[model samples]
Target: MRGPLVVLLCCMVALGACRREAPQTGPVDPSGDGQVTISGDDLVIADLNWTPPPVRIEEGAEGDARARAAEALGDDDLHATPASAIPLYLALSAISGEERAAAAGLRRARIRLLALGTMALDEADTGDSIAGLRAAHEFAAVARFLAADDPDVLTYLQRVDESDRLWELNRAAERALDAGELGEDGGGALAGFRQAAALRPGQPRAMQGLAAVESALIRRAEVAGSEGDFQTAARWLAHAAEVRPGMQTVVDARQRIQRMRATRIQRLRDEGVAALPKINGVAQARQRLAEILTIAEPGDPVARDLRQRIDRAVHYGDFRPGQVFTDALEGGARGPQMVVLPHGGFMMGALPGDADAEDNERPRHAVRFERGFAMGVREITVGEFRRFVETTGYQSRAVRRGFSMAYDERTGNFLRRSNVDWRSDYAGAPAADTLPVLHVSARDAQAYADWLSAQSGRRYRLPSEAEFEYAFRNGTSERYPWGEGTPPQGSGNMTGALDRSPSGRRWGNAFAGYGDGHWGPAPVGSFRPNPWGVHDLEGNVSEWMGDCWHATYRRAPADGSAWINPGCRDQVIRGGSWASSPAQTRASWRALAQVDTTNARIGFRVVRDL
Candidate 1:
């Protein structure tokens, strides 16, 4: 008896009672075969520390019962044949008064009970658990009656306790998982499962529980990312990875964050544009762009375009129409005083039924200023040009060519004169610094504008022809800059009938009974400014425009952009000078001259982007 029991216990130990197997369900045998089997949940725990129930051997059955039980237990498949062996083991425990025989029965029943109940997790198998429990209860009572202190008996008791712990862990894990206690929040299904796996690693129940928790976390991450909450998405994915590192689902979920950026940025842009045109529109739009750049990839065209529009909006918001300002230059000097113009639309050619209308002013069309810019409040002054020339030592076209068109006062006509430059006024004489600079080529004006740009870190350029006309009209489509009939007292310094030259010569065709104080160009801003708060736009020297000469208003730009081809020799000139006749001062008048042409009647002002 000891030999078979010893061999069985050795096998159980070597197989490691702590090692868990994947579930392999074997069918239960319902037939008890008249054996006294244990019945309810009560017996599972009640009999673990059993006491003896007065082992009085039956009077004449000890020898025969012992022989039959030993015969049943001798079979190698005794654990599976619990229906046959459990009854025999019980019979022997009762028939024989020997504690050794009872111990043998307890050992057989323990192995048999585990074989039946280890995987018998179904509640429907009350009969199987009862049979194992019944055998253990009866046999363990008698077996421990005298052998309670025996090493083998004590060892068997310890194994039964371990089995109970494993069962409890699995049940707790299952319940926690069903209750949505996934471990991202801590102290949930993951804790129970980890303990169970540590006790019996790679067990099916614990591994499945861990997988469930991981899957739930990944789903949460996906939901957050879809709604553009990438921060939350990243947090959840990180938690999922921590829960189970190297999980493919978490890795795939993390990749989706980058893919969602396109939709997110476009939505923000739409919101920003919609909010624009309000009082705080630019501020709101700027905030939206900041968020966009955080997620947008470098060089994204949509992001770049949004930034540019916002910058333009900022300029629009920062200034008001008719506002005056000046930029600081490098040496503490200031650029020309400038006045801001309002954005507007206007008819761009001659008015109907006006006698001064030329063919070039026909074919009227609409022109619009979508954004406002700052224009010089007055024509470029002689003092300003002297600073540029003295600073850069630049050679004007008149200086290089040694001659330019000037007022030949003796003949009462303009003619080429040597030594005439920007310093000389209309009469070919050195003039006061306050006078509008003259004898400057269009190229020279451009150079001065370039120098101002570099000094002030701003863009300074000649006005486009459309811009000049827009300022000339100042939002009114009048026949003349000052509107029809004889000129007002000091409307502009055009040729007048009462005007007298220094040599006592008077105009043959001029405004009747109208005379400015001096015959030649008046000092800049000497006359009242137009409605736009800009002086000398049409009355000072005619200003150089940035466009090349186009014979008519045909195919002109409606957006107020310069309609110029680079290197075109004949550049446009606009407005009226002191020598201009009444017809020349009409709002629709335009003319062109060679790029290198320099004359006393042509000077320039500048316009800068806001």
Candidate 2:
């Protein structure tokens, strides 16, 4: 019995195993009458992440679903879409979350929805965005942010399947918010206000901001004024007046300006002209007059008064017309015997008791000469002198071969052994016609005077000491030609007073201070001409007067004429030369050189009765 039972169980087990392993059959289709049978791989389950896993769509199912998804995505604002689609998109993403086959469908819906939401935001003109143009910008920005990590997401976002009607929803919302008709949180909306202000400066809102700052300044100024800080307030008000638009502000500022001016004028009056600062009252008054004229009526008395005051001030203390003379001769050439003197005068000698008075001026006297006499206008110009030399064939003493006395710096004294001729001394000099023939002794001066007298058929000789002094002192008793004081720079070329030295080693003696530091003669009239139109009077070259140097005034005559020593041979040099100091250039100053001594800086001027 056990064996039989075991065999039965084994048979049952075999039948169960056969049932599990064998293919199953089902009822056949009635129309076809074909039996239904399971195939080897029938009922295959796909590896999916969701329940009720994805089924392959019948032929056109995918295309239909894609079209629907695209249509949904066409909304400008997916966020404004029917809330029902949200769950559908969420569900699709979850269902195809892990299956590559379902991913395309899920991704298409997501991208379309995202694109719509971005379009909605853009249409809102997030920051005062221009209606049509800026909306696209906002849309693009949002779209970019959403698809940042997806390479192909942008392609789907650009699709515009529907009329983008969702954009109208956003636009309506933006307009409502702008008009204050909506209760939307304005923090996001405020961005547009700021952007608009930035794009268009000085708009209502920008102007308001500027006005706030300006008003604050105005208030501060008013507070300062109320606190008795008028000056500070005035400054602030002045600035406000510049930028303030109202005529009232400008008028107030002008009043303040006028008040300040009046106060200044009162202060000046109290201080007196000398004590007051050297402000130009006339100029200030004129400026005020100009300002008044701008607001004054044409025939107003105040305007008339201001005009008269300006005219009077302009003419106040002005110098009267004076005379300045020039040579009447054409080309300003020195005529054969004619002379022209620019008008001026000088002191004839030292004061009676002046400490350093020289013996010759013991009886100090005042002398004056008014008439500007005709004298040789310039040291005979080279052209004129050359004609004389050419016509007369007169050989100048300077051309005669002989050594003359010249200062030697090495020896600190005069040296007499050098052979310096005029031609060699003045190398490359212009023709002698224009050059005052230099290297001529006093004898030469007299000889030239004699020759000129004969040529012009008129008396022309060296001026006497008195005549020369009178000629030099044109009409005044001042120390120098210009005035009683030392001459100013440019008054004449002379050795500077400051450069004078007592060592006698300096170029020219301290006595030779007039010609600006030149030891030898400069071209005639190179220095500033004397007021009397004389050149080289206070420097350049000493003149050869017709008088001898007198040790005392014991026998001097009082007449304005030369007083010559009965037995004196050497001629007097009345006016100091470039080789003398300021003190020696005085009208009465005197020196002596041998009558026959000839060298540069010893030229002479002649005197002729007008």
Candidate 3:
């Protein structure tokens, strides 16, 4: 067998050497193993004489008959051409008296025909293929019938059909490469190579085409990257992946781009952050953000961080919107915890569906904040108010008067009580540090705000009526801060019908099915806050606003500024208190009090301009 194959191979090589080669302008396959075609012919194919099977008309089991038939067929070497097996199968099929003998002959003939046809096409010479296929088909049709519907035979035929298509696809890709159409508009190489590879795994020509295209893509990406067109470079590498996914060069290239983006993003962030403290820092920072956005991936941490910084630039100092922080006082002491409200706009009066809207609350017009401001996280707590009084040696208007309104838990009524000042609780008892301060007149509240401004070097003042309502609304246009329907349990210290006073007395009208566990003011921060993260904007107590008393919003300032009538005796108040009725808890509810009128139900929160 070795002697015949060696002699045949030597003859074919000699024949191939004598033939003239055509000059190809197209790029040759980089892999020498690609486009393999066996250079041989039928004369070069070797075969051996076989001893024919003995006549066996055994009327026995089908397996026994097939076993005898296979014994006669002997060892069928797949590597050798099936030429000699054809004569033996023909003679056996001719002598068949049983179906088993005829079937066995047909199976052997099918195998020989399939092998001959496949081997013929393996050579580059069309003459050899035509002659070889013609002999195999003529032998099968005239000498014996083949089982054409057999799975193995059908699969081999289908593969033969697909090879023609794959050959064309791979050739087109190589031609595209030679034409310098490696995806630069005269395109098709990448798509062609990728399609051929996917359609036929391990096809040598397709694999070679893909490898060549991938190399070209890598070179193109390198050129673009060297020119500092990183985005364009990345685009090339992405195409390389489509041609041959997970190519190490492409993987490494993408990682390099990510690192470059990270480094650039970091540098931009540093520059933008540095510029934030300068006079025109925000303007400078915005420019950096635009560039980073182009290169940075979506939801990049550095990009998100830069954006947050820019947003916070419009807030007080370094504080972000909805963030709570405390400003430092003169002696390194921190002031009230202030929550930054984002600069935005909102309707400043009663909501549309609110049937209880008052005349003064009509004309719900838009009030916009041109800039952001920070408000005390809660109404000035008793301890915080005490700090102001102690620092300035201030005598509150109520203290000067030596009397203020105080609640009587027994009668559930408010009455004037002597010695009831900022230091007093609702019942004029000694207040806890955590409790919200009350019984301080509007003038007294102003003094504390003025003192805070002087101490912290920030503009601390009472919020205007509009600002107060807007802040508490926290981006909602609903009538209640907690939304429509019954308030959730522990929403705030607002009045509830189920709540009992120290005397076991319940309110005639309050939020039904809701109890905040308090009949009077609870300690500040005891209740759940509004959505803005500010505590006790409602329910703890009604609050004093900077605006003077007005009958309506007819001539109101649309900019959210206080509508002040200098020397006005009356001041406006907003929000609901623990003892407030259900109707009083409506978001737009407001009332007036004499500037000198200090009350157990009213307190004030400060806002600092950003």
Candidate 4:
């Protein structure tokens, strides 16, 4: 309200010289118009129904008044002050006409502003922090309006610098939590977050950092308890509780740890470990290990070994240890399932013992992924590709070319046919939209990726040659993903005994014993997924990769990144198509074709950065 400002102005004019000649008293307005009435030398505002003590200045009293005002504004809990004391201090400064008093008044205003701003950066209450920050800004404007030339105003502005420091501290905490370094020393992101919270209360990001750090610590404590290191586990869980008091995760973890004490954590650990080898899939093994860790003690050798095994399995694509998620495209119209891969090293090429290994698959060079990424759980199906086309009005290369290679039963091999494109099946019937879109060129695949990237606000592109092979092998050096022999039944849609139809007769060579129950491309994800939770890497259709075609790995990049030559016209293709033979279905098999090459046997999947 303007009542405070009006009172301030009236008091300043009246007290400039301590020349109060007479009492200008008026009726106390019951209407509450916030009218100020001067009674004797004291000032009163009717709305507040409050009166200030008469201003009486003695020799050298200005210093004492200024000091007292400073002490009041500098209280530890200035935020709880009933009302701002700025106007009273200003009246004192006017009556005393001392530069020190004026400066003190401004200093007090600045102190209050800083207090509000400090609360904005580190408060535990997210809503309060936001409101506090806004209030701090408003207070700053008022202080500036009161005295534009005061040096204390600049001193108060330094809080902005403190806010920046708080930001860095919060960010450090986030980085530490995300990296899983919960140590109390330099590695402790929780420590930094707490420090920031102490400096500026109620910051949302800082609170989030604390929650993540505490959760990680709780998980560690669970592991430690399982390993019989109750002391260490208790310490970590206590620390988590201290950082995020009353957090449900901390409460649950504590209860679990207590239960482990009664049941003897080792029993569960032993049971889980014994079940690991019997598990049919990596996901099952990971689940068993996770159960063991919940009661295992921190730093337990057995728990450590199990964790390493799970990590290796996940990296090799034999296990998907994390949750499967989806990314929306076309403004949430399409959500494609994806699997996360961890950063790791793997032998990218074929093994030396493989009899069917080609020369191009030689050198068995090492490849590493420095960062994790997400891959589509299956090849991009016609349904997905259709969305991209409909949204962007994109024309695939096959469509523009007016023809693409398709299986011709009469020719008993793939032949170029007019009017054949991604929309047409090999038999010239309308292709099922659920199947992997075929007759799309490498360029067309990249275009679709580009469209997806633009629509989803993520980097979506074809996987590199190494990424494809890594996912295809799925932690195995076997010729085929399933095993050294023929692929298991219903493993993929590869050309098999089932392709014996008139249309299947076109592919003269097929895996002799295998019958995937499909002659042409089966609907995406119709068969079992690879160990990495990806479907149809061995069949459905051969996928285009981002790498430029290379005859050998003589100079290929050691990192799992695409190796592209700007001038190259051919791109690499991996994962055999449904028309491929047993040897062609081998994981290490690689092929090169013109960038614009389109065929019913070729389709693609996509990769996104994590």
Clashing pairs in 3: none
Give the Cα error of residue 54 in candidate 3, in Å: 76
| Model 4 misplacement above 4 A | 1-321, 503-507
Model 1 poorest 10 in a row by lDDT: 28-37
Clashes of 2: 33
lDDT (0-100) at residue 587 of candidate 2? 63
Where does model 2 exceed 4 Å of error? Answer: 1-337, 340-347, 366-372, 380-386, 398-401, 407-413, 417-436, 482-486, 497-519, 555-559, 565-567
lDDT of 2 by residue, 256-290 (tens): 54455455444333333222124675666666565
Clash totals for all candidate models: 1, 33, 0, 15
Global local distance difference test of model 1: 0.71
**lDDT comparing candidate 2 with the true structure:** 0.47
TM-scores, each model vs. reference: 0.51, 0.39, 0.60, 0.49
Candidate 3 local lDDT, 1-610, one digit each (tens): 4332223332222333432322111233444111223222222121212233234333444445445445444433211222234334443455435455656565774575455445533421222232332233332232223445677666655555454555556556666775657763435776776677687766555566666777777667766655546688788877777776766857876777667667778898999999998999998998898878977778989989988898788554576677778889998889898888888899888877788888888787888887788888888988999998888899988888899899887677899899998888999999998889998889889998998899989889998988888888888878887788789887888888788888898888888788888867889989777778887766889999999999888879988899999999999999899888777888788899998888889999999887
The alpha-carbon lDDT assigned to residue 351 of candidate 1 equals 80
What ranges in model 1 sit over 4 Å off? 1-283, 286-317
> Cα deviation in Å at residue 257, candidate 3?
4.5
Question: lDDT values of the candidates?
Answer: 0.71, 0.47, 0.71, 0.68
Report RMSD (Å) for each prediction in the order shown. 15.2, 28.6, 14.2, 26.5
What is candidate 3's local distance difference test score? Answer: 0.71
Please state the error at residue 13 of candidate 4 in Å.
79
